[model samples]
Target: MSAKSRKKNKYNFLMRMRPVLRWVLRLRSTPKAIAGGLGLGTFIAFTPTMGIQLILAVLGATFFNLNRPAAVIPVWITNPITVAPIYTFNYWLGRHIWEGPPLTEVSRQFLEIGRTMARLSFWDIKDQIIAVLSMGRDVLIPLVIGSLAIGLITGILVYLFSYRLLCIFLFRRGKKRLLNNN
Candidate 1:
């Protein structure tokens, strides 16, 4: 994309998130709390806990006394639009780490299993296990390890970047207030 188009896209994305973010950025929390919460959320986003990431992030933020929204919002990183790519990459990274079937083979098997699963009833627990096993050994092991590796690395980077940016913003705001008072 062109630079202008990219910037517009970025702006649009932010505007979409404004509702969820309107208060968090305005909160008078410390950089550590905001950044730490963001980091925690980032790590959790990459985990296999798709359905419970937000809850986990919120609980973690509460336990750690971090900024709640900062922790919770990042969990949206694993939303429907992003889930396929994230999980696929996780599986790809995992296979490289743990040694397994190639990406194409595993992805094909996974699709077949997914199709079977769609027709399956919730009561068919045994059938589910068998279907999962048909692809899990190749997908599960690598996914777990790769998810952890990516989560940790990405979380730390997010924390550091957010901390620095927050610090700068707070410093400038404080200085502006001081100048106005003087």
Candidate 2:
């Protein structure tokens, strides 16, 4: 593409993003509201359920009258690229909290078990499923607890940082307006 065309495309992209950005900036939320939104977004982002983050964020933002875009944007942090790391961290955190084996050891064992299972017959697969289902509580309990803890921590941190940044941006704009008026 020509330089001019590239520039135009860039401008167009920015223009399209402007409405969403402005919506976030114009939110009349108190600091608490902003923080709540950020925290909620972070919590939703780390949910084990996939493919529903955006919907959850929209509902949360609307219910709370928060900046919808601001609340939704941070959820992208838990997308495909970061999923493994986030889950691994959660697993390790769970292990620590539960006084269980380290995540790395569990992961190694899991891999070994998976490899063995791959060579199993269809009947064996069915048996495995039944076994897992029978003891589902053992697996699920730790997962739920760890995910909630991590989500809460992540939410608090995001809220604090975003609130501070938003405050700075608003303050700078107010200062500029005063200077212009003077």
Candidate 3:
């Protein structure tokens, strides 16, 4: 596609998304609830669970008494294009913080185990599964720890910022409507 066409498509897509953005920003839920929901969704997105972020976000929102839409939508921050980089960074941060084995060593051992699993007889499924889970545990433990720390910090900051912004925006909007009615 031509550069101009690509740009046009981008613009069109953004235009189409405008109403959705407006609705989210102007949701009738209390600012604190909306902000909390967004914070919860963002926290879930920081974790390594690629497929279940939305479910986690919704569950968190429901349990925490936050806005569902706000919670669910922010999880999209970790999309297909961004997942690899984000997860890689999270893993690196995890290793640094939690004292895991070196990435290279873990990767090499994982590959060796993978090859062994492939050579195993189909009847050895339990052993193969155990090997896989062992490698996964080595990686996942640190990652989960780091993600929890980062997600909590990020969630709090996002909540504070969004809460203030939402409060100001809603206050102004109410005043504007009141003026219009006067």
Candidate 4:
């Protein structure tokens, strides 16, 4: 359990997994399909919704004729570790798109409201709820629009980049094989 041994073990595990990863990547599919799959997968990954990655990827792949596996792989980008930052970015982008004012003061107001909620009587709580409800729409509307825009732009970029990269790799490899056979 020493730190050095733990590091070595982790490295060994990854090394062992390399072959499986390579085989998955080597599945017979056109480069364009693979690229589209990767792009779509990455795009879907940004959504905060859970348990939908594979379903989205499959549907997207079928509709777009992308490589299912490629499209699915990048969907893990928004997993537990990255979710917070992703959501924060999405919220900020949404606010910007909605032309909303900064939320710093509003967030402080929310924190204060939460702190006071326990001290408030029933009537006070009702008033607080009314206040929040009135303000919530303004804050949320921009967030939704911004997140959708970011997801779409990111997806398209991922698709184009993946497609181009895969194409170049395949083309170069094919040329090398051809030249070697001569």
Candidate 5:
């Protein structure tokens, strides 16, 4: 993209994020609370838990004394558009980290699953179901492991960055406005 278009895109992205930023700023909570809540939400979003993420984030934020709204906002990161890619990358990373199953084995399991689904039900063959479940175990273990690793690192980075930004844009600006009004 051209420099001008890139700038416009950047501006548009910021505009899209404006509502969340406004919500953050409107809260009377401490900067740490807001940042921690945002960080907690971000961390929860990266996990394999799809439906319960929002609830988890809220519970975590409440337990940890973080801002609830800030905690819930980042959970939207794992919506339909993003869930597949994020989980796929995490699964890939997990496979590398723990070396779950051979690629050929995974590929074979998928093909077998497809064939079973197409012809008869997977429940039709108990042995086949067992094999698929075992294969699933191999896949699931690594994905969870990798997602936790990524989430921890990302959550920490987000906390630090959000804290710094809140300090700069919120507190510093408020102080200036107060002084100007005096």
Candidate 6:
């Protein structure tokens, strides 16, 4: 398809999703539960796992007594559209927190492996594993540490903010109901 059509479709999809996002934010549930769920879901989102966020969120919510729907839904924040930037930021943050070999070194090793794979000269499996491990050695540690730090901070902040927002919403709704009854 043409680039113009792709852009138009993406824009239209985003427009359609806006209302759904509003509905999610306005979801009617207890303040504690919704906030807890938000915190849990957000925490899981920051972790390295991309494929099983829903399952992780559900299990975390269940284990933590958070709202199931609330917890599971927000994990969509890490979809393909946002994953690269998010992970890049997380990796940067992790590097700041803990020292690791430079990304340049890591990238060089990764490219070497790619070149080997492309040539298909029948490199030993051990060499491939070593190349991968070297790549991971520099990236993984920082990513994990940074993700944990970002997740914990963001989750706590979201929980607090969601709790207050829900409290206000419920209070206003209750006041309106009472006024109507009068």
Per-residue lDDT tens digits for candidate 5, residues 2-22, read: 999999999999999898788
- Clash count of each predicted structure: 0, 0, 0, 1, 0, 0
lDDT of 3 at 77: 83
Quick one: RMSD of model 4?
10.1
Number of the predicted model whose lDDT against the real structure is largest: 1
TM-score computed on alpha carbons, candidate 4:
0.64
Better of 3 and 6 by lDDT: 3
TM-score of each: 0.74, 0.62, 0.71, 0.64, 0.77, 0.70
Q: 4 or 5: which has the higher lDDT?
A: 5
Using TM-score as the yardstick, the better of models 2 and 6 is 6
What are the lDDT figures for the candidates, one per model? 0.79, 0.67, 0.76, 0.68, 0.78, 0.74
The clash number for model 2 is 0
Best by TM-score: 5
Model 6 per-residue lDDT tens digits across residues 1-182:
99999999999997998886566567666789889999989988887555567788999989988789889777888754565556566777899988887766644543555555444433354553354345565687887788788999999998998788778868887899999999
Worst ten-residue run, lDDT, model 5? Answer: 122-131
Off by over 4 Å in 1: 1-22, 108-135
In candidate 2, the residue pairs with backbone N, CA or C atoms under 3 Å apart (3 or more residues apart, or in different chains) clash, namely none
lDDT of 4 by residue, 37-137 (tens): 88788778765333465677889899988788887788877643454456557667787667665767545544454444445554453554454345466
RMSD of each: 4.6, 9.7, 7.4, 10.1, 6.9, 8.6
Residues 1-182 of candidate 3: C-alpha lDDT, one tens digit per residue: 99999999999998998887678787879999999998898898887665567778888899999999999887988664565456556667788877776777665654565466456664664674465456567687876777787788888888998899888878988999999999
Residue pairs in clash, model 1: none
Number of residue pairs clashing in candidate 5, backbone atoms closer than 3 angstroms, sequence gap of 3 or more or interchain: 0
- Model 1, 1-182: lDDT tens digits are 89999999999998997765556657778999999999999999997565567778999999999988899878988754466567678888887879877888776665665566567765565675576555556577897788899999999999999899778878887899999999
Model 5 misplaced regions, further than 4 Å: 101-135
Query: Which TM-score value belongs to model 6?
Result: 0.70
